[model samples]
Target: MKINQYIRQAQYKKGFASIILIGVIVLVALGGYFTLKAKQKSSPEQTSTTATDQKVYTISDTNKSTTNQLIAESKIIESLKTNWQSIQALIPFRPGHPGTVAWLSPYSVQFIGKNNLLVGFEDGYNPGVAVLNFNNDQFKILETFKNQAVFTFSDWQSLINKYGNSSYPVSTYTVSLLRNKQIVSFQDLINVPENIFLKNY
Candidate 1:
């Protein structure tokens, strides 16, 4: 009777040990599955964050480039103003002309380049455009379109097409220059098409 009881106790201990081992294996497998799932979910979020950071950096670089370009353009304009003042002092006046007579029309000043200015003058005899080189202190006549004709808008376009190759031609009614305080006239003006001029002057 005593031997039979010991055999039964040993069998019960063996069954309990098997149950504990199976439970430990199941827990370890579940832990590994949940850890893998977490890593997969976080990968996409990390990629999204990296892309957003790159876009922000690209925009910042573009803004900085535009700001630098604007600053450079401002400096160029200021330098042109200073050069204009020096050129104004060099214009020669006629011997008998009074101080009231302007050497060149202020309204007719046009900037062709950084150091080049196109000035118009009318002295009751000659009406023409003069090109001034600020760098070399030189001046030369560009052209005298008409003696005394009705210069319409079309005529101005023709002048630009023939000589200037300018994208923007001056308006018709705008005064070119003055002769003894009188507005210079354009007579027998030629006709030209307006389509040749560029849209953005």
Candidate 2:
């Protein structure tokens, strides 16, 4: 009777050990499953954020690859020559108007991509630049700057960054050229001391 009791006790302990092992295995499996499910749920959100962060700038509706800068500039020059009256009328401070301190004229013309003409103007005192788009038998001014806005390097950088749509950014090369021309025009006025100072009698 004592041996039989001992045998029964040993069997009971073995059965308890088996149940504990099975519970541990089940808990581990459940933890792994939940971890995998969490990763799957977060993957799409991560992908969506990446897509939004990567905004791409592109050249639109122009022969960027084939258009020569010189030839494109010529076209803008011809257009300006032919439509000088109408174009000047569209600008502020017309040459003959009262209180007009500046006479605006196209100082520099560059052919950037997207049928856009980057033009610089001088008004004797202040220099300005504009990006003109030719469409439907007319020229439209897309962007314009005058005075300190066109004079400083910081403003130039800001204009380069801000002068375009979300899809099409302005060309930095053309903006640099326009800035250089405006600076030269400004220098032409200031570099002459006689013009700025009264003549000694």
Candidate 3:
């Protein structure tokens, strides 16, 4: 009877050990499956967040660049206006026609080096190009080509191609006055349906 009880106890011990081993294997497998599932679920969310961040950064950079460009353009326009005003003040228009009355056409202003500029203006009467030189904080008329015909876009392009060589830096800005007296850039004028080459002469 003692021997039989000992055998039964040994069999019970072996069964318990098997159960524990099987339980450990099952727990390990479940842990691995859950970890894999969690990683798969988080990956898409992380990718989406990263993409959103990149898009936001790109838009911010573009806005900053656009703002800076607009500021620079405004400064250039102000400088052009100031210089033109100074020139008009120094060289008064003939009697009965003020400088303000003589500047009623599309104008092209080009800033050359060494504080020099070339300005083309068309006023119902006098339409031509003039070279302005800034010296000692004062503006002086270097040369003037008066009574020129109205030049179209093609004409201006032809002139530029004829005169502007690879060696010459011909950076310029053109502006036109609207019927409402509002000044607009030449680039903007091209998009309008109205004819931009309305000759006063």
* lDDT of predicted model 3: 0.52
- Give the Cα-based TM-score of candidate 1 against the true structure: 0.27
Q: What TM-score would every model get versus the actual structure?
A: 0.27, 0.40, 0.37
- Once model 2 is optimally superposed onto the true structure by TM-score, how far is the C-alpha of residue 60 displaced, in angstroms? 25
Q: Write the per-residue lDDT of candidate 3 for residues 15-120, one digit (tens) a residue.
A: 9999999999999999999999976664333455445434433545657654443344335545556666556544334213345453543366654445555566
What are the clash counts of all predictions, listed in order? 6, 0, 0
Off by over 4 Å in 2: 1-69, 93-102, 148-154, 161-201
Q: Pick the winner on TM-score between candidates 2 and 3.
A: 2
The TM-score that candidate 3 achieves is 0.37
Q: Which 10 residues in a row give candidate 2 its minimum summed lDDT?
A: 189-198
- Please identify model 3 stretches exceeding 4 Å from their true place: 1-77, 92-106, 135-137, 149-168, 176-201
Quote the lDDT for 147 in model 2.
Answer: 46
Q: lDDT per residue, candidate 1, 37-136, as tens digits? A: 8756643334554454344345456576534433332343345344544433454533124453433332244433444444544445544444444443
Residue pairs in candidate 2 whose N, alpha carbon or C atoms collide under 3 angstroms: none
Global lDDT of each candidate: 0.43, 0.50, 0.52
